[model samples]
Target chain A: MRHLIDISDLTRDETNELIETASDIIVNPDNYTNKCSRKKIATLFYEPSTRTRLSFESAMLDLGGSVIGFSSAQYSSVSKGESVADTVRTVSCFADIIAIRHPKEGAALVAAMNSPVPVINAGDGGHNHPTQTLTDLLTIVREKGRLTDLTIGCCGDLKFGRTVHSLITAMARYSGVRFVLISPDELVIPEYLRNGVLKRENIPYVETRSLDESIAELDILYMTRVQKERFFNEADYVRLKDSYILTPDKLAHAKSDMRILHPLPRVNEISTAIDYDPRAAYFRQVRYGKFIRMALILKLLEEAEE
Target chain B: MIIGSIVNGIVIDHIPAGRGMELYKLMKLNELKCEIALIENAKSEKLGKKDILKIGEMLPFDYSILGYVDSRITINFIENGKRVRKEHPSMPEILSDIIKCKNPRCITTTEQELPHKFRLSDRESLSYRCVYCESKAQSN
Candidate 1:
């Protein structure tokens, strides 16, 4: 009964194995078309999400599995005051596996604790989104051709961006990886990540406010939106939302081969003008998301059988 | 300065000096109606000065809480005015309902029925993080 509650739950070997499986699925899609023909995936999203919810549905559909469950709390039994444990327990009776997304941190963990089937944390508030980390890893491997000895520049909301945090945790496992974390003073990386991962692992990293200053040395630039939902103060959200917009001017200083990545549904942090740039791989990152999820579903289902 | 010994009770010994009050408040000893003595800054050979707690009645005690507060704490069971057993409390791997998660986004905050759980993350620093949100537990 393994569950993907946090990025650290997957060892470095397991993460790499998932990346390889996702890559193989991309190259040979037909071979996996009926891997889960009779299986059903319960998509229990307690919050609003377009990309993640659809990615799970699309992944399940691509694997010949049926998708069930709600897109938001207002549409589900959760609105009727059903607890996450009860909802997951009920859903597990009808589904083969469960993929949960909740605004509250560790909600999926609660689901995992109660579920009989394997649980996948689609996204859990600003806490962890391990699938997004997998998507980013697959994208980096496909774009940069390697994961080691690279400088990753994470810009925008380093404080509450679960994607950035998960990516850092995943990347820190590889050798010779340094980080250039760019964010406003208000949105610096959390202390657990700074002290627990980077400092504790002896990984080299630099914190700065200027993305342009750090862009040139980066092999991969991971940008994130300053999520409004994470902020209790609307005034703080308004002030920090536009802290780092990736304009064409900013791209002029970056390495020619530097790849730009963002876990999508991005606001204006990335200018529309950079969409056509060869380095802009966020759209491709979204495509990689579906494949990685397909790989994850297959892996979990296979493990469930054994 | 003279705290009488109990005939049938428990004695918690070897708490670092000045931390007895903290342990008292944390254990909610004030809520108990039974006789209890908190001997603070008591002379000790091991700690030079230590805090000791004597409970006049044998109540269900969660020694895990004492271990989390201070691993050096020792518990002695007194029966018929004689020491029956001495137990050294060790740090528990998981702590449930001992401390509340302050992170507003944690699921335990909204689901009142959910037990507030924390996992011992770093033993060296005696750090525990909320199982729900991974926020560091605020030490009392």
Candidate 2:
């Protein structure tokens, strides 16, 4: 009866409950293996995304559910101009739940409205990705042992990074959570998010151009790619591209316990040399991603039964 | 050369000739309790044709609703068979909540149970955007 079209739809308590359920699944994977035995999950990905699509597919598979639907829009009736409403309504008759990713903003919201089954937004154009935020939250809670009172530094492409926006919104709900935003002037945290979410919640935060200065002080350093396309000026992109690189030498000042996180598909933002460092948790975050997704699939299917 | 007049009501005049039906749909005046007269294709040297809506009873209207359909509608507050007050159109700060967003991928386009929400991003330009999908639309 409910859809997760936006992170704001989930209250702080609901978020914590999901995290707790995900944790329980991690502990007892056997008990939830057949949770969605005869159910089906349709992944309607309109864009090319191997990692996220595979994550959802694998999550449903692990929950003993079958996966149906296309990996791209080109293969679907969308190429012939079938409307999203008609597509979702038809798909709902076959699938119990749907996960959709579209290049257009609010596409999932649209699908959710027409879908008879619950809808999950995998990713929509620079808007929101609540699932990725869920994965990140689960990773942080598991790695940092707590969500509050931590100095979380988010670096690169903050303006357009949906992941960054979702993470900031989720973290702002916790107490004593300070943020250090690291990005070029063009990619600084958007004013809407800064004023609407951060300032409104009275969450203490600081913005800086130097990632090195704040790199050591952060309890968790989350990195995202600063793509050249996001820049209007090529020269500016070239100048600021290397400002957020997380090299092993840079980790020297970081606490031995300081956890480094990245959403993956790193384009030199994170140096491969830091892969050996025990503080690097991005790879482990991937494994945790699968586990948490497995947990999510079980929970959603169980809720469908109720 | 005489036309029927309401005993005690409002008269919307100077509605760009043939656009009275559109104005009617925009205001949803047919759903109201008052007696309505829609005079269409009336002779006018300036517009070549014009239409008028004479209501038989006083009905409250925001008048700003005219901004969406036609800006030429002139509302006359007739008192004792005298035009006491005449109101003309001005640019509106907000647009009507009707007219669904054209973007097929927009949430508002598919959501049947929710009210279609739009915000006038540029009033002078007559540009509006879907609050959910962020799709831009312009009034032509």
The candidate that wins on DockQ is 1
Task: Tell me the TM-score of chain B in each candidate.
Answer: 0.88, 0.79
Model 2 lDDT per residue over B12-107, tens place: 887887778878877788898877888998877767888988877676777876765566668887777777788887646555566666766555
lDDT of 1 at A61: 96
Question: For each candidate, what is the lDDT?
Answer: 0.92, 0.81
Query: In candidate 2, what are the lDDT values of residues A135-160, reduced to their tens digit?
Result: 88999999989999999999988987
Residues A230-271, candidate 1, lDDT per residue (tens digit)?
899999999999999999999999889999999988899899
Off by over 4 Å in 2: A228-243, B1-116, B119-129, B134-140
TM-score of 1: 0.94
Record all residue pairs in model 2 with backbone atoms less than 3 Å apart, i.e. clashing: B17-B50
User: Could you give the CAPRI-style class of model 2?
Assistant: acceptable
- Report RMSD (Å) for each prediction in the order shown: 2.2, 7.4
TM-score for each of the candidates: 0.94, 0.76
